[model samples]
Target: MKATPADQQELLRLQSIDTRLQQLAHKLGALPQTAPLAELAQRETAVRGTRAEAIGALEDARSELTRLESDVAVVEARIARDTDRLQHTSSVKDVQALEAELASLAKRRSDLEDQELVVMERVEDAEVVVSSIDLQRAAIESEVAELEAERDAAAGGIGVEREQTERDREVVAAGVPAELLAFYEQRRARGAGVGAALLRQRTCGGCTMTLTGSDLEQVRRSAPDDVVQCPECDRILVRTDESGL
Candidate 1:
């Protein structure tokens, strides 16, 4: 359909507004704080850190247990050697000295065994903690996967909408005069996506301010096909049949 230069300009302005609106929607959708994928990623990072700490603790516990066992073995060997010495020594003085050494070795062995038992218990507790953490990590991974899938689906939908909006913009852009389009773009850049609005009831929608009686009269007398800009907002004002005043 044939469109007047004024109509074409208005259409272009509408297209620009729609394009900006679509971009705003995309920007909002992709925000790190708002996007499900980003939140999932943060959670994944935390889970990984927790798992690392759990693994470290488990390893430390195992190492402590191993060390304690080795110490117990050394103490037991000392006890065995002292017992053999006590049995073989013939002189009364030598036997008495050997008995004293054996007694000390026995006490040391007992202490080492007790410590080893404590370490073994700690190892068991650590293993349980590791197992529980593994399960928690697995559950978090599953949730992350679900969130990624959801995010992908949502982004796909937004992509389709973006493509449609771009197509619509192209169609609308083809109708506008290049000079008018340039003017609107400049105004839009200055005013943050609000470069044009319908003038209604003697008010400029761009500024939300009513026009003076003289200005209203002047605007009314202006040619219908002419492009008019709001003096206050510098936004192109479209006069409409539905303007109440």
Candidate 2:
């Protein structure tokens, strides 16, 4: 294929633009905050699980405390009724029985009260555990929000750069011969992202292999407008004064 020397050089500019676009795409995908954000997501899931368990424990403790309070209330009511009867009793035998019953009720009430206190302490501890877990979850959420904001900002910048680079590519590519550009695109797809390279110092810039003997002679014999390819990498070889012929 024949392309003017000037058009051939434009291929290098196109390649540079394409390479920059590729770098920008890679940067977008590999933002520094991406991995940490994923890790924080996993951490948040685990933390939520822990928080759910803590909440369950707190609910259980509160339920137990309620039962204990109810038992204490019932015992106090019985004690009050027994004390009233003891105060109004006429017979000595009746008075003794009432006093004995009142004493039993008092002991029962004391035991229930003790148990209620213990359960109240457990409820308080459970609540503290839930509250601490809440704080931890909130911290994780905050960090996640910050990381997401950073990731979005980084991606937005890359997107803008990519759009500009693509526009530059379009303008550069429009100047290239359609047949030559198509061939270049095909080579780029089949091989590395680079489709053309400078032949500097007798070396194939695409593969970095020095041309010698017949290969060097062949390139020298070719017309200036004749497209030449590197024997090593099959990429279009763009020659200039630095080609070291």
Candidate 3:
């Protein structure tokens, strides 16, 4: 294919942009914050699970405390009834029975109070667990937010630059012949982002293989308007005065 020197140089420039675009796309995919954010999300899920368990424990403790307090109230009412009987009855047997019942009631009430105290302590401990989990969640969220902001701020500039570079590539590509650009794109796809290489100092910039002997002579003999392909890697060999041809 025939291309003027200027058009050939434009192809090289387009190649440069495409290469950088490929790099930018890779960078965008592998943003620094992405892995950490994912890890933090997993930790967040685990922490929320812990919080859920803490809530369940607190609820159970509160429920047990309520039931114990209710039992204590019932016991106190029974003792009051027995005390009233004592005040009214003068029989020895009746007085003795009432005192025995009151003593038993007192013991029951003491046991319920102890159980209530234990439940109350569990509730307090559960509350502490909830508080600790909440702090952990807040710290994780703050770090996630910070990482997200950093990723966005850092990527913002690269994103804009990539967009502009892509636009410029389009404009430059439009100036080239359709067949040449298509060929370049196809070769770029097959050659891993390099369709054309600068033939500098007898070296194939695409493959880094030096052209020598008859190969170098062939490139040297080629007309300036004619496009040349490297014999080793089959990439377009773009020539300049520095080609050492």
TM-score of each: 0.52, 0.55, 0.55
On residues 166-208, what C-alpha lDDT tens digit does candidate 1 reach at each position? Answer: 7777777677777767776787777767766777787877788
Task: Give candidate 2's TM-score.
Answer: 0.55
Predicted candidate 3 versus true structure: per-residue lDDT over 21-68, tens digit per residue: 999989977998888999999999999999999999999999999999
Ranking by TM-score: 2, 3, 1
State which candidate, 1 or 2, has the greater TM-score. Answer: 2
Alpha-carbon lDDT of model 2: 0.90
- lDDT (0 to 1) per candidate: 0.73, 0.90, 0.91
Clashing pairs in 3: none
Off by over 4 Å in 2: 36-148
Error of 2 at 9 (Å): 0.8
Q: Using lDDT as the measure, which candidate wins?
A: 3
Per candidate, the number of residue pairs that clash is 0, 0, 0
